[model samples]
Target: MILFRGTGAAACRYLESDRSRADDYYLEGGTALAAFTVTDGGGEVLATSELDAEAYAGWVDWIDPLTTKSMGKPRLPGEEGTTKHGSPRFAEMVVNTPKSLSIAAALHPEVSDALDAAQGDAVAEIRRFIALHSVTRVGPRGHQEVVPVERLQTVAVVHKTSRAGDPHRHVHFQIGTRVWAAGKWRGLDTAALFKQQGAIRALGTAVLAAHPGLAQVLDRHGLTLDPVTGEVAELESFNALMSKRGAQVEKNLAAIEASWDEAHPGQEPGPVVHARMTAAAWAKGRPQKRPTTLAHEDGWRDELAEAGYDPELFLQRRLPAHAPIDVDDLKIQTIASRSLDRCAAAASTWTRHTVAEKVTRIVTEHGVRATPA
Candidate 1:
């Protein structure tokens, strides 16, 4: 599962350099948060499963509109975690909203509910959340930019082959702030969402007691059960528990592998045997030849020279210094520039006529601005 947050521009920047690595990590169920303060800092979520390619495509189709593009690239593996640059694709990080306000909580109704919902509708819920929080506003110069918010960008769920996560799935979402229909954005105090005693208690019962011995080890590792909910606690405590559990599980697996090697020295089968009787199989037809791709001698001249092989011809090709900007790049650059402009405006003073005059001059000279609406 990959959770994306922040501005599309920021997300694009992160994606360009490490798209492959990011995808690799995403398959591992990592969350990626991006937000563009200069643009609407909405968020998006993606879950990765071993679905067939068609199912994967279906998932993308369901999620594409909510996000900005088909090439779903979260923050590249090495970029900073937060989305600060303004990208049209950028959205906030999504995490668990309060149980009361969470759409997942509402859909599930009961924590153990197994009811299935339509994929389209589920994706709609996600899109609704993004649109409801996306920034859209006109500034002093009637410039548009996405306003930044500390919203949950995404939640990721990773299903492992073994008893990872006690088989509990889904990375939760917690969103704060509201993007109103009136094109205004406001912050929502979502701390109350985390104050659920029942949830806490449930966590304690389900995860903490799943394996009691492991629970004791978790406690020894500075991980503790919450007093009020009797559930495994969060923040640093949850991380500590996970780390310790992972280490123990790894150790156990290593021990099992070592034991297997000791029990069976080289091969597990009884013993290698040589058969006494053998008959030769005859092929009476013409031999099959391997196929090869067409080779161009013209292009091989440079390589041939380097390898000390003279060539009769050389291919001359001129490559451009830069490729055309893609939609994502344009969006990111626009958002970034706008953000810088906003900052500059904030740090300075201005008069209304001065702004109007500038606008008038532009309108008079260019007739209209055609770059971005």
Candidate 2:
């Protein structure tokens, strides 16, 4: 599953800071920063040495002034309001792995490669969609323009376990808000990017399904496909277990909101108020348990069997020759079509140029690359 969150400049600053403790190593003596970019395309360089913290901080701060600020009052006709600066300058894209895939990655080298391939495919699809759909205004009259994000910079951080010490594998994609377009930097229009999150998630499942061993393992462990969508479900047992902390956070937030409402009377709580409440809830914290006390892989398998999945049948099943569908091509076409349709509906005069330019760029960029699995 892919979870998305738009963050403020302060959050971005903290994420790049030493206090963030993003120091979890994937390899011996290796740093957590896996990749960084400034483009929306697939070309990103993996870090050879340690992450350049100063560069990351600089990038985040450069776009901070461009973030949407509080207006303090309502606007008159033609007056710019909160959205004048566009959306938030930082967003987090979290790609979560299934329990089966997580365990497989830990226990088998081949599975790790499959996981990497699946993750790569998902990320590429996401970037493609964002490139095609990102829209921004160019002039004082709020002229709608399709500013395709040619380069999207991101810091990909992989985590092996959850904060609760559960067996979890996920990648945090810290995407910068600025993109190169029309010979200068522009604030990214993330409305479409956020809208197509479901399609992006489906692409991830489809790509993972292309890996036969991983699919079978997932099936045996109760991450079976939904009959209608062919999308796999996360192991409910594990998901529910790990959601305890989040549930508590939600509960605390609710209580805080209620108290604020009672005190404030008719006034609605704003973003800043909600943010403070959430921060206080997080500060309260949850008890940590050692991972050593968690259930082993075998225990999880046994639990799956007990949950009514046919482990024997899952083991006997052969790998499908192909995925249930052409995930890569289908996703690309879907996003492009959606973007073009929206442009047409909006009576955009630049529709032809936008479509032509985006198509040419996508084809030229991906033509030399191998097809995704």
Candidate 3:
């Protein structure tokens, strides 16, 4: 990252902040600054602000002022080990060199899109891949680690490339500091290491699975995939295209989860196995299979109440001794659980109903099937 004048200076100025500000405030400022410089948000979200367009234009104006044809590409001063044609040899060298003995791939443009899309589906697809492929975890001398969902922080970068005009574009990615299990760090845990390896390999495998046309995609951009590792090759091919035009994609899992909660605010995040097991135990101990036990109704009522359904609602419905029951249908029932719902009912207000609808939408993503009958 060399500091070219003009738009780069503006961007740098935005990054430079008053050191005296509080940490939280300073962070807000930085985010605001980045937002102002990169977005066309139309005055809504900072990250989408229109200032980005202006800053970019200013940058281009500075870089190619006067719009005159030059002898060749302008040389960047003090850049060493680079070709006279101004190729970024230093970056190329770093990426080409193996990070460890294992066949390695640096985050680069050629396969960046597929790499990115792979991560999006990694959680589910990778688990499936690991189960299918007999890939085992490499112990102390391994190439990966899997942090629990709670411990992982993911970031995304988009890579691009081209040949004649655009040249290569690729994304370089770095996973910041790892989180240890149970807060422990810096010890050899081969089992844990292998588990993590399974996860990382899953990510790589999923990328190819999700986007089988990656080689073709690269070819369209004057890039090619490395057949051996199934990755994109050629730095100048992509780098020159994306030099200052690429972007870092943001992963918004937290937002998605929050939306999920809005859909099913009172629903549990884990499996329903325990609830089913308890129901099974109750079913097994019934006498004469009459199924009208006070204990059974009470248990169902209690479970429903705990989950936000009004237990009394179930009582409003008729149940009989040894009635034909669909086991799945008997598993659960719904009622508004939040205090807001209660308040709304008391005041005859409609606002809570709207909020509840929103929350229902959020929770439904977790496999809760609700149908209006």
Candidate 4:
């Protein structure tokens, strides 16, 4: 799954942090050093092809002040990336692995290499999605035009566990919002990325499933991806046990809501208030993370052991001989038909994004297994 969040120069600190510090001081992510630089909070920091000292400086306003027009004023305070207008300083894309893969990698340390290979493939696919869909929106009032300019200045950091310390492998892709287009810097239409998150997610998963390294490794480890749902069906129940983060968040939210209800009798909170309440819950529920706490093989094994789970039992659970449908035989049109039906149930109106997402749903271009960070 891919979760999109609008952030700013702050994310560079959290992702690039190689020391012992959490960048959760405030919502805007926090600031980093002025030096040109750049995670689901992935462990090791990996810069995208476009990221460099200059680009890093550009994002943080340390250098190359961004603006919509070539000769316009530089971006003001709190408007680092929005100098191009309305776009965030960064578009955060959180890429997560399927439940089964997370579980398998958690149990077997050796499976991490496969996960790494898969992550590479997944990153490639995401870049493709960005290149194909993201554009620069420009023009006068009510005469907006979208220009094709697809590329992201991203800093990807790898991580091994969820906030709850579960084997929830994921990647945090902080895409720089400003882009070079039409001979000047402009804001990439991040709304396009945000709106099409669902599509990118599905497309990413499909690509990961088809990835030879990840798929072959899973097979070697007695794990298999269920074609229909795209999860390792055998470990569904086990995977459900690793819902500590979700459980904690929900518990905190409920407690906060109840407390509010107790204090404010007969008064319902507005969306804005409710949102604040939710954020409060999230803040309260956040774990005091070390970021490298569960990095070793024994750490994860001990966790499973304490939970009374025998890792060997998982491998022995086995898989069916072959997939129900030959993956190679699946057609984009067939996938599109089913996806269209599902979309039709929700709304009648459809845009290119809607159709593209439908294709993303069933299109198995490839797959990624996130390695330990």
Best by TM-score: 4
RMSD of each: 27.7, 9.6, 30.7, 9.5
Lowest lDDT sum, 10 consecutive residues, model 4, at 18-27
Candidate 1: C-alpha lDDT = 0.28
- Please give the CA lDDT of all the candidate structures: 0.28, 0.48, 0.28, 0.56
lDDT of 2 by residue, 204-296 (tens): 444444544454544444445332232344333344543335446556656776788699974654546655665565456655642233334
| Decreasing lDDT order of the candidates | 4, 2, 3, 1
Expressed as tens digits, the lDDT of each residue in 1-373 for candidate 1 is 1233443332232232121111232243433332111112343333222333232232222233234334333343346863453112222222221211111211122321311111122223443334334343435546744443433332222211111111122222223233222343332223322232222223222222222333333333333323223233422222322222333433443454356547776432211110000000001121242101101212222322444432122112212211222223334454445545544575575443234333322222222212111
Best by lDDT: 4
Superposition error at 291 for model 2 (Å): 5.6
Q: Which run of 10 residues does model 2 get worst, by summed lDDT?
A: 16-25
- Per-residue lDDT for 1-373 in model 4, tens only? 2222223233443343211111221114333332221211121233323334334535534233223123223454356554334334566666778866777776666677777677766766676566666678778859989887633345555666653446666776556566556776677676677777777767666666655556666777777765446677656667766554656765676688789879997565655676576557657847674323444446556665677766567578776734433455676567778878868976888776777777655554322232212
lDDT of 2 at 10: 37
Tell me the tens digit of each residue's lDDT in model 3 across 1-373. Answer: 1222222332232222111111222133333222111111121111223223234233222221122222123234344754434321111000111111000112323444444344334332322322232122223556655433222211222222211111222222212121123343222222333333423443433244224344344444444344333343433232322222112101122233356558876443332432333234333433353222212224323433444543243334423212222224422233334534544665665443344443333232222222111
Q: Estimate each model's TM-score.
A: 0.23, 0.54, 0.21, 0.65
Compute the lDDT of residue 156 as modeled in candidate 4. 58
- Model 2 TM-score on a 0 to 1 scale: 0.54
Error of 1 at 321 (Å): 70
